[model samples]
Target: MGPRKITAHGDKGAEVQGKIRRLGSWRRAAAMIVAVGTVWAGTVMPASADTDLPEYLTKMRAPEMWKVADGTGITVAVIDSGVKDLPELEGRVLPGVSFMEPPVSRPEEKYPVHDDFEGHGTSMIAAIVGDGSGGGPHGLAPGAKVMPIRTSIGSPMAFGAIGEAGKGVRYAADNGAKIINLSIGGWWSLDRIGPAIEYAQSKGVLVFVGMGNDGSKMSNPIAALPGAFGVGAVDINGEPLESSSNGSATDFAAFGGKVPIRCKKNTAWCMQDGGTSYATSLASASAALVWSAHPDWTANQVARVLLQTAGGPVDGAKRNDWVGYGIARPSKVLIDRQGDPGAPDTDPLASPTPQPSTPSADPAAAVPPQAESTAAESDRSWKWPALGAAVAVILGLGITGILKRRRR
Candidate 1:
């Protein structure tokens, strides 16, 4: 969660402001920010340098977290570039599938899940439930499993791939994956995206998707449907990331700020790396911890607990558009002995946005600005409201997420 400090955007008690201050009642009502222009102490910061979370390596509250989520027994499907299997992750990660096609194959590395050009996915998996075998990253839920589902490929802007990323979403849900983490994005789709999201929610899987880093362009799909939780990125200081993206699509902003990432597949000692992708992975792992602790709870209840207990100012309780329910404080859930898991049959979100129109394929479909010049509202909108998992052989999305076809 970003600092619950004061801000210039809205009132003091505004949901955003309250989150800045938090429950303990900050010393002064003053909202503070770091030199870099992002959210700091509840205020819009001025542009500055890298904003990573501060190092506070505390002892594991529940050392047993590893026993539950080695990511071996429970499957956590990661839909992104690919897993390159590093030394620390040896024997931990599943063999996994790739969407990179034949010519471009999974990176040739040793460990278990150490593949990726972006390095975001690897870092996230580590945070959620790192093996910690060789003193590697230990995940919040160590006893869980890891599921890798590769979707879409390419570099920065001009990236393109199979149009059907939805397939991956479905596959994850259909499979037995309990958690889905999506760190990727594209334009919104009511037709292609909506129904698939509904499927995941129905399956009782928790989906944690990143609200794009392009706050000025796209919209967030945190919980595309109710019950789902969207996650935003924050720095080590508990503030928002300059490029982490924001708006209503966010349900829970996370620690996406600047942090040193370990080396990728071949080498170690990574220099520069961090993004909402990694944060989402951490959020997914955090969810795993909550789920592991309360195995019987449905995805909705787990999600609600995380949001309800998330650190925030009691004065402003409404969910925000950009930062959604606020920062995800799984620690709160771990300590809340009396927390309710919520009803199993009911949905979390009050209303799911109607599906968006698709292209020429469907008879009732509208042209839709699929090629529109505008960026996705979830990504660029100033406010956001919303939420992922993976599948197996078919390589669907994380929660019963979007299931796109693998390219030939």
Candidate 2:
């Protein structure tokens, strides 16, 4: 059957549609994950779609934040279908690797590491670093560079997709990528991808992963993996998008509802889309802004400040499953300079004691004794239970089926 259109409406009077690809299972482990590549393509009816900036940017106060730091000298690796160059991404997209099989039977022009077959990778890149030239979607960190790493995740080759994605993660860590974005979701075994995630963490690279679009049914297991920050999606009203998966693993939330994305069927126009995929990108870009401004800080330090400055839990808890610490607000760090950098080697989400890693040489990298105690008490109080819950979900559940995008 041919692809069907899915029209969705949002507060901005913007509408979008695209073909949907249902989730497929991998028999080896009876595992399946929601693919972030679904693009609901159809007619867009916004009155001024061409000239308007995404509402999230305005909400984020992106212009004011950019004046402080634009993610200069930071590189984010996007692992997905691949990234096609867009005018908004000129001179910023880096040469990246791909793990998909060679299209030997078809014309070589039809496939390349940057082909962007699903337009998923390109949208992600644009969300992080697009320059907004010619009315394209402007990224949160326009000065950042994107390292494209293409891999097949939702195709007939589903069985090997995780392995390919693992290699991409490792490559990103080894190649100086400060941040890695994995927007794919599913309930695959940790044995397949855990090592690479750990490797990235060990290399001091922050990995931002999507919580999936499964809503309350489940979050992506990958987000539950240790050392990975699971990101959920929130609407402009600071409420969780009904489609964004949530659980103990959700570490953060971002503006994902009706997010401006490069159109899959047409590159000339932008479409409003929603998912944890775009939320993850925005979270990663927020990290870039912090990292670029404090280039001397270790990954742990950058993460610490973000956690400290994020919009705190609405319920006044240290952290919650729905929105993690809270919606990521880099402005707190960039504009107000409110968050404490903490110890260079200590993980804010983990114990307060210094991790067994090299300490920062910067004179200002030391943590205050009081700060360490406070953070330790607060994090231990909340993080361990959530971690246990996430681990349990990973081993106990065997969910499968279509992960449809939610429309309001």
Distance from true position, residue 362, model 2, in Å?
34
Candidate 1, residue 126: the lDDT equals 62
lDDT of each: 0.47, 0.65
Q: How well is each residue in 297-363 modelled by candidate 2, as lDDT tens digits? A: 9988888877776664443455555566677888878887877788887766664422221223311
Query: Which portions of model 1 miss their true places by more than 4 Å?
Result: 1-73, 101-118, 133-136, 155-164, 188-190, 215-217, 221-228, 262-266, 271-273, 313-315, 351-408
Q: Which one wins on lDDT?
A: 2
lDDT, residue 119, model 1 = 46
Q: In angstroms, what RMSD does candidate 2 have relative to the true structure?
A: 14.1
Tens-digit lDDT track of model 1 for 1-408: 443322222321243223222311111110100000111111222222222212411322244333433333456776655555666565556666554433234445232223565444565566655555443454555567777766433222102222233566677788778887766554323245446555776787777777655442233332343334566665554445556554444666666544334443323433233456656776787777777777777887777676665543223534444445555656556654434556765544442311111122211111111121222222221111111111111221222233221000
Clashes of each: 108, 6
Go through the candidates in order and give the C-alpha RMSD of each one to the true structure: 15.0, 14.1
Model 1 TM-score, 2 decimals: 0.63
